[model samples]
Target: MNGCRAKGSWVADEKDTVHYSGAAGGWGSVRGMTEVLARERPTPAALDTLRRQNKPGGFMCVSCAWGKPKHPHPFEFCENGAKATLWEMTSRRCTPEFFAQHTVTELRDWKDYDLEHQGRLTHPMRYDRATDKYVPCAWDEAFAAIGTELKRLDPKSTVFYASGRASLETSYLYALFARMYGHNNLPDSSNMCHETTSVALKKAIGSPVGTCVLEDLEKCDAIFFFGHNTGSNAPRLLHPLQEAVKRGVQIVTFNPIRETGLERFKNPQSPVEMLTGKETEISSLYLQVKAGGDIAAIMGMIKHVLSTEERRWREDKRHVLDVDFLAQHTTGFETVKAHAEQLSWEEIERESGLARADLEKAADVYIAAERTIFMYGMGLTQHVHGSDNLTTLVDLALLKGSIGREGAGISPIRGHSNVQGQRTVGISEKPELVPLDRMAEQFAFDPPRDTGLNTVDACEKIISGEVKAFIGLGGNFVRAIPEQVKMEQAWQSMRLTVQIATKLNRSHLINGEVAYLLPCLGRSERDMQVTGAQAVTMEDSLSCIHGSQGNGHPASDHLKSEVAIVCGMAKATLPPNPKARWDDWTADYGLIRDLIEESYPEMFADFNARVFTPGGFYKGNAARERIWKTESGKAEFTVPTSLSALGLGDKEGRWRLMTLRSNDQFNTTIYGYSDRLRGIEGTRDIVLMHPDDIAAAGLAEGQVVSLASDADDGEHRQVDGLTVTPYLLPRGCIGAYYPETNPLVPLWYHDEASKTPASKGVPVRIVT
Candidate 1:
């Protein structure tokens, strides 16, 4: 953090400030598409890659999971989706010659944007210790080397990490392999993003998956978006919100920043909007809540609701609450009700950074609405009390009888397109191993029942030299985690590290004693195999299990699908097992789906036939059916009234920084230096701050400043050359971008319950 460097050109002046006019996706979106079209210059065959995006017989975009519309438009994809597709299907190739010229040390200095832009990796490569470079190797050789390391180390200490971008088939096979190899150490992207939502929602609604589908947006009387930026991260979602606005659905938002997408959106799909430049107003009410102030806002809303219910109950003999629904389907409501009533208005206002009147206004809308959909994103989940915040939101949803009904439930707008799918198909570190008995019966072995490490725990063990080897299915592992340098150094402690990815990321540049880059097929590229060109399955944000078939040919001849790569690793690593036919699964992906059906028979019955159906089938949620399946045979409420919003104490000037993504990028991949939505151009070094705070801190607009995190854990945590820009933000609140601000977050900073890093809100002090 101390020696951090800003890469690339940065053009910002003192007069620079947030200047997005109240509209999104007109010419800006058009410009985004053309920029990639001109730069990538994909062949006519590759251009067809986007034809199948978000539609039946198409591959899922490796971007955000805003859920998919049942009736996908002709241009099913969005701006960010276009970028991801073009980036993946780019003509640029990273040949063996490229690796021959660049050493690990030299490539390490290149920025993330430059590294990935070099293009698809065309061959399997292994690290050469002598030359400190990667040399081309055969797939078998790579798998054998990883197998040798696995055999040399304890399976308990070896962890397998999977990204959400990986197909469901790959995740299923990975879990099967991990169990076959006799290790429960499986951690994936879920631990970093929406683990809190999954864990908390299950307790409240008796389901781990979201209860609503894309169709729910059409019917919901009121839609509340908490801690999400739909316009940038999940662009396709804006279209749905725009439609909802047209239908007069009351949309309320709670976020730290006034995202342009939440303000207004013009659907590029609409000819009238595109031609006339007409925009749809999105949020009916937008509350700029503090980063970790979600729980307070939720509590205040509940407090108001409870009072209204009491008054209504007195006015009429009939109950104001949904007496039948609550009494039959839920437990511990009175306890939550009591706690919310006791919450002082002053405390809620101070913690949430919201006026009580505004909170009351939102509450009034909630009380008036008969059906509501509560949706949230990383803004609420990536906090010290992330799980608690989610739980509190659930409490409000339940109090208003918002859950366990059509068009009324708690949902999370997943950032990664297939991230939630990874979890559904069994990529979990702290897994219940729910079907362990069934798995043992079917796979002919005793699967591990104990829960294993998550993202935070796995990294900690790696830092402590406990984890011997690590394999990532597909993700920028070390780059996305907290304490960037410390975690990067942790890679060197490993005996083996394997990155199964399409492109060369920063993780590939950083090396372990021995490393392997098993180049895999991109999502947009067809995974041709023995059983014809295979189509993989993916679950969208709303738990719709759909088939994603690549409409285009392979990016590189040397590339293997994630299914093939995983099968190869498993065959090399595991002892002979006749029951587990790794070869057959690799040859035919439908066989993988057959095995998945065997694992989750009820949810994925006739997996092959059903997944191919038009919009795919929704995995049945008991909550949506009003059937509770919790410990009490009812959806039990767990009260969360904790005030622990951040790691650093509630002190003035100790600004709460919320890490966000620019429109130019998705996750760790940097697409460009500009965020056109926020009017930021040619620079990512600018930190958005309140105009008053800039003067109070003795700092001027566009003045470059250093940020030192308050987590004083002996190691210095600071981001360099961040130019301060005045903006409309709450006092003691600021905004920073991901990967750049990743170093400022301490390793220990995460929710104790969910273990998700407090990336959305970290306490830091500006060192001018």
Candidate 2:
């Protein structure tokens, strides 16, 4: 397009930056991992913790939710997982003395990376308004103050938020405590990430989770990946993909950016591959679609498949469509087929950024494969029509009878270790999803049946001064959300805010009128309750539930496990209810598991026993067994009429921006400034764009620019001082780091059905 320099010299002006053109996960991953471990200078205890991570009786990795194999490798941890472990198990500590040195106002200005790099927090601290600093506070006093405030405010105005890092046990207890306290406002990380997947899948297949296990990837003849960056988000999944490639499985990927992780991979664990520097090519066909163009791409495939079916039938009286499977196991095929028939090739090509020939090639691959697996991530879900995007994926699968087979199903690659488990154990805003009758009978209290607030709704209430308090079990809630400026301002209006965390974050600096920072033990630390050393359970992306018990020493003597922290809050807030013995749960988490079983018997039956089994047990899915749990007793198709999922027409001087994570980052937790795969270093405040787009906008490379959201909302959402870097992308698409670019997305710009923030695709204009 413009300024055609050598591929490696795009950033010649910046000394610290260089584009990396090597395959993902070889010596580069090794160097990156060494740097990560060297930051903390691995202690003996930390080394031991690494050895036991992802093991049967050891703690789960506090990272992505990629499934574990039946017999995991000794070093089952990925580079990101190592960063997570060492980041938590670091010897450096954020003590009371550290907080005393900096006031809340001063700490608010610190970068998120710097705040977390200070290491694990070691004491419970409360904000001192008069002094503008945090001082040490006893755990009992903090809980008592929180309880008193909760009792004072209306339950409807309070929210209990959970991050995806919590274990299933902690999530269960947290949900129970919130319900016990007479409210169901349980907004969690899922609301921002995969709530669309849950909403769409349940309606289409009667299951909210994936229908495949780790073995499915091995047996599948083909796999289609959409909008997921495996190298940075879930590096562990690369090994299996490499194996699938070796075994002659066809893999196709559709993403706006050509991620290095998905292009080629060199297995770090393979001695021969690493020594010889040989890399395995990942995707057989990589389609660089425009941002938010997945729906159009899928529609094009459907059109090709249908056209082939009609041509074959006319030529030789042969059938190409899975007619029997559609009649027997699915509904709404006629509607989907009719919709595909009317669509013109010109519209599909224009919207999808793919030519008709490329779509036919992809469709041919889909037809040739006996079994195929469909996997997608946040890119497809973080849009105004996110649910529509997922349901459309299901329609294509059903067209080929891809679901309810051994190696075929729709998979939404989830974030965090236990995000899905948290929802499974009852962290939900919808009251109907909970077992209200069983909970009432078991706990001896009338449960609240009113619908609760999601993250976006809670932010709205906080801004309007309607939400009085916020209790975050884990996560940097305010920092990771939209409308960063407004959310930070609204956070001050809360009467009380409690953050149960292991490390310091930006959310802690954005204090409420009365804020308490409670220090909880990290997943890598030993959690010895009254019973003995305790183990918790986590559910992975494959719907497998497994046990995880910490092996290392606690970071601080004053720290407590998450279950204990939940118990302390519950006991202080509620009067003595004989049936709900909160104290017993702290001593023995098995008691909490029993209660979980009582609440959701169908899913969690024999919870305590099955969870400890080697490799864990598969939580069965009815849809996998050809049993439709949908309202019509069959899989249903969804046809979205809009070409642009966001309902926006083409506009000149506009770019659809998708926020992404760097190789050195996980979610909002920034580890370093360098995005090793993208060849970025020294800074994160840069925007990646196609060279043609930059030249078309009359912007020169390395020029400073400002981006303003193109929303009709009156709010001027903009992020300035971003350097323009040329990259390979579609004509009207750009990429920037998340939480930095989150402001450009309006808080109201989200999926109507699921309320998930459209973080992946925000329309913006560049200002020189």
TM-score of 2: 0.97
Question: Which candidate has the highest lDDT of all?
Answer: 2
**Residue 444 lDDT, candidate 2, scale 0-100:** 89
Counting clashing residue pairs in each candidate, in order, gives 0, 0
Q: Write the per-residue lDDT of candidate 1 for residues 47-163, one digit (tens) a residue.
A: 677777878767777787767666779988888899888888888898899999999899988889899888889999999989988899998898898888888888888889988
In candidate 1, position 594 carries an lDDT of 90
In order, the Cα lDDT scores of the candidates are 0.83, 0.87
For model 2, how does the per-residue alpha-carbon lDDT over 1-768 read when each residue is reduced to its tens digit? 122222454434323323567778998888888887888665468888888888777778999998877688878888899888888888889999998899989988898889998988999999999999999999999889999999999988999999998998899989988998888899999999999988999998888887888889989999999999998999999999999999999999999888888999998888999999899999999999888888899999999999899999999987777899999999898999999999999999998999889888998989888899999999889988888888889999988788888888888899988999999888998988888888899988998998899999999999999999999998999888989998888899899999999989989988788999999999888889888988888899999988888888898999989998998998999889999787899999888888888888887889988767777778788999879889999999878857666745568877898999999898989888768887777788888888777778888788889999888667888999898888878888888889888888888889878989998888888988
**Poorest 10 consecutive residues of model 2 by lDDT?**
1-10
Worst 10 residues of 1 by lDDT: 1-10
Q: In candidate 1, residue 316 scores what lDDT?
A: 80
